[model samples]
Target: MHKGNFKEMYLNTEQLDLGKFKVATSETLYMTVVSMLFVIIIGLILGLLLYNLGKSKRIGAKIFYNLLSIISNICRSVPFIILIILLIPFTKALMGTFLGAKAAIPSLVISAAPFYGRLVEMAFREVDHGVLEAANSMGANKWELVTKVLIPESLPALISGVTVTVITMIGFTAMAGAIGAGGLGGLAYQEGFMRNRPTITLFATICVLVIVFMVQWLGDWAVKKTDKR
Candidate 1:
């Protein structure tokens, strides 16, 4: 009877170590914010490049899309763990270490950039072609069309795209914990699971859940506020 008491042990905790919980949560939030910033900057550049290249000619545009599609496919094909491992050397060179929040930035950015780029590309694609034509009809230059028409029209979709990117980064940050990257996932893995501390594990899980839900709520609010239609 005593041997089957795992469930009881798991649920016996009254609370978690708040300091560990806070440190882990802050690391996760940092990683997600930095990754999102990189994704936004890189995604915007890629999207603009696609748009510019696509507008040159019918054949050229198809070629551009095909190239981007292939790149995206390749990046997407690599699993995140493998990608992180593969990038460890670069992370070290850039960050002087590859086992903490700073080191995880490149991997997070590399993983999410293609993702957000595609989102941005698709968001821009959703802009009305006729509106673009109308902009051109009004002598809107390329930059003007991009800033005034394309981006504004797709602001809501872009916000949604960022939401998706942030959520994805949260998952990635959890995985980064294996490399001594401090986050709730890492805390759960190292202190809770490995050390047999159920209270710590439960606390970490709850923290992640709260963060994810909060991000989702904020994202929904931003979409509603930005949506023109």
Candidate 2:
């Protein structure tokens, strides 16, 4: 539907004016959930590997850790926007196109995984050394140490880190909107700036701020519930 000037856009608060925005919000939520799942899963794996390597005394472990460290640093060092544009071709190859929520996953996962991975490593490291020693005295294997000791011990911090990662990823989704990923950011840009509809833009901004606040409150509550210390 053709929208008139800003005044008409504000006066006409019908579904037609909001249809695309609703779709964009759905797309944004889908992308955030999927991307966050990838981040958590992949980050846990990488973090476990790094933590093990750091705790080991073997030469091969050191060599492998160095390489992994370099890779993780590089991924985190590059700005998100540059990473998205640079990886567009790869994302397209992976998802069949460099637009829409699906296409945004590659860059999101690539960037977010390393970020969360660092947190994971730190969380595990924060586990008490005495508990680790006790586990070792009990003849627990590496798997047992991780499952029964490291993970259980570090869970509170891990939850907090993941919460922070989720909040960060929400912002990333907005940035991804600039590349046709269809989110609040894209809606604000297209409808507000391009079409000069401040009402739509203000509404989009409010939606994002609300989401961030909701996520933060939920995260804090979860963290408090999980934290026994």
What lDDT does the true structure give each of the candidates?
A: 0.85, 0.87
Give the local distance difference test score of model 1. Answer: 0.85
Tell me the tens digit of each residue's lDDT in model 1 across 66-105.
7987887777678887899999999999999998887899
Clash counts for the predictions, in order: 0, 0
Q: Specify the poorest-scoring 10-residue window by lDDT in model 1.
A: 6-15
Per-residue lDDT of model 2, residues 1-229, tens digit only: 4556655766445523667778878887888899999899999999999998998999999999999999999998998889999999899889999988889989999999999999999999998899999989999998899899898888888888888998888888888888788788788777676877767777887888888888889888988887888
Query: What are the per-model C-alpha RMSD values against the true structure?
Result: 2.3, 3.9
Runs with alpha carbons beyond 4 Å of true place in candidate 2: 1-16
Model 1 residue 74 distance off true place after TM-score fit, in angstroms:
1.5
Candidate with the greatest TM-score versus the true structure: 1
